[model samples]
Target: MILKTFGWSFVITAVGLALAVLYDGWTAFGIVAILSILEISLSFDNAVVNAGILKKMNAFWQKIFLTIGVLIAVFGMRLVFPVVIVAISAKIGPIEAVNLALNEKEHYKELVTDAHASIAAFGGMFLLMIFLDFIFEDRDIQWLRWIERPLAKLGKVDMLSVAIALGVLLVSSMTFATHAHLHGGAHADKGETVLISGIAGLITYMIVGGLSGYFEDKLEEEEEAELEAEEAAKKSGKGGASAVLLAGKAAFFMFLYLEVLDASFSFDGVIGAFAITNDIVLMALGLGIGAMYVRSLTVYLVRQGTLDDYVYLEHGAHYAIGALAVILLVTIQYEINEVITGLVGVVLIAWSFWSSVRRNKRIAAEGGGDFSEKAEVSTGV
Candidate 1:
């Protein structure tokens, strides 16, 4: 299994890098490798969050996630996305955009610099809402009737997230709107207003993300009830609905959620990567490599049952997400480098892994022995 997995990853990486090399040669290879590692490090939190959803998915969809999904992630989003953004903003065509990125590298840099604030604002607000929902919303399984009753009745659903996003949009818009005019300068040109794009992105995020969450919760509840029923039926020696179908449906949404989560995480990395290299091919290669690592890490979490073993891993990732969101928001006024953002996530994930290992060892010790001892006992040692 290990060899097969590594072999597949090798093939994909080689193919991706080969494509990069075709476009830009040896320099492209280096850029992709570095960017890939950077993206992976920055997105460890993304992997953890994805594992939470991916673990619940059926095997087939999970394969799609690792396979087709990676293409969409690395090429579609990481590579093509920035080019598209540049093209739209610069009022140039796609072919010209690509040519500009390759030959007129400095111009590409200027384009990314100009768009940075708006990207930060949109991505920041989207991630902030995600963080707030996770932290403030009730996720506990209500097993007891008494507790569920009053809790459900009195639980005030917080709209503070929406309000906060709106506030950010308003402030970003007003600030950009007045920035040039107040300086007795020329009127801000179209597609140059950070405020408008920021507000639009934030509003779109709220609408799409909110609706997704609502449906996700509903599906999750249905799945939970179905699982319980199946378990009960099994206890009574009866058959149950195909677990795979239910799992597939559950996984589909989880996949969607994971993609959205990835997009959120990639926001900063995407913007920061432009700061390093404006070669579209190089940017794609580097960021694609990073995305591959994240996919591999997500699978590792599931196969290793890290979440089951380490209770706090998910919590730590969410905390990191919250911190990233805040950092993105701060970057609107203060520039925080992508390297710093990437390092912060790496440190947090490393700590969580260490904590998980310790917890697993402690549990094994408390259980009176290791797996070898249990095996011996079962064999009548």
Candidate 2:
């Protein structure tokens, strides 16, 4: 089942292998392979999160995500984005950035990693919001009832996530300042950098989320009208943006949301890949392979209704994302291992998966062999 949907991933893997062999030999090939696995392992949460949103979209948009979106994932986020980061941070042209990546590889990596505090701040905050929104929303099923119930109750307090995130940023900033001062190096302004980037991330999320939510309301209206065929004024989402703004506006916004979400998720992997190899091309190829598989898994999850089946899967993914967000912020002052970051997500997801399986067995037994029949009505949170 996975193989059929992930055929494109196989093609990507083969192409990456061939490119690694042709360009840098077997060592590079091995590095590419490791990078691919690293990306997949680190980004399983991304796949689930994407699926949660993708299932809301129509088939056309879903295909666009798999096809056009994959190109952006591989080229834009994996390569050009890094070059742009280096270009802006290093005050060099894109070509110069590429040259640095190729020629002065160590310096290139340093430039990339040097910008980590801000990157982590921005991405971590964006992700923290995602996690907070998920757990804060009133879900029917409470996987971790003890933790989630209180959060849900607290969510009624307006801007709880924002307040909590800002508080963490402030504390992180203070800790960062003290750490930099004591360490006696170029870390003097890291706390300030984190604050600025974290705010920018928060703003980006509000804009993107706001736009998407507005369009979603419009789409829902259209969905309601179509359900009754009561009016021709309401256009189907498939027919395009329904004369709302411009052509493809709805889908385009969805596309934007997905791309930004993917970028935030990829920030870690892109930086982490440097630890494995300095070759930008190899990193792109290797990580691109992983990205393709993640996209495939997203599509597979959407088509197979995995989220609906494993009720806690999305919850688990968000919790993993929340942990990652905290870890990213923590890494600003402390050097955290990528392996630990990856493992945290894996462990949370695995526990949730196991819990889901047990849940299914219980449901099956209680419902006299048909779990799906009472699944919708079952109490979950």
283-333: candidate 1 lDDT, tens digit per residue: 777787778778877887788777776655675687688789778766655
Error of 2 at 280 (Å): 0.8
C-alpha RMSD in Å of predicted model 1 compared with the true structure? 7.5
Model 2 TM-score relative to the real fold: 0.90
Q: What is the TM-score of each candidate against the true structure?
A: 0.77, 0.90
lDDT, candidates in the order shown:
0.68, 0.83
Candidate 2, residue 67: the lDDT equals 92
Model 2 segments more than 4 A misplaced:
177-187, 230-248, 368-381
Model 2: ten consecutive residues of lowest lDDT: 177-186
* Model 2 C-alpha lDDT per residue in residues 1-381, reported as the tens digit of each score: 877889888988998899999998999889999999999999999999999888887788888998999999999999888889889867889999999988998889888877778788889989998898888887667788878878789899999988988888788777862353212235546777778888999899889977887787777777575555634335543432233343256667877898999999998899889878988999899999999999999999999987777777887899899999998887776777789989999988888877777788787777545433343423232
- Candidate 2 Cα deviation (angstroms), residue 208: 0.8
lDDT at residue 257 of model 1 (Cα atoms) = 63
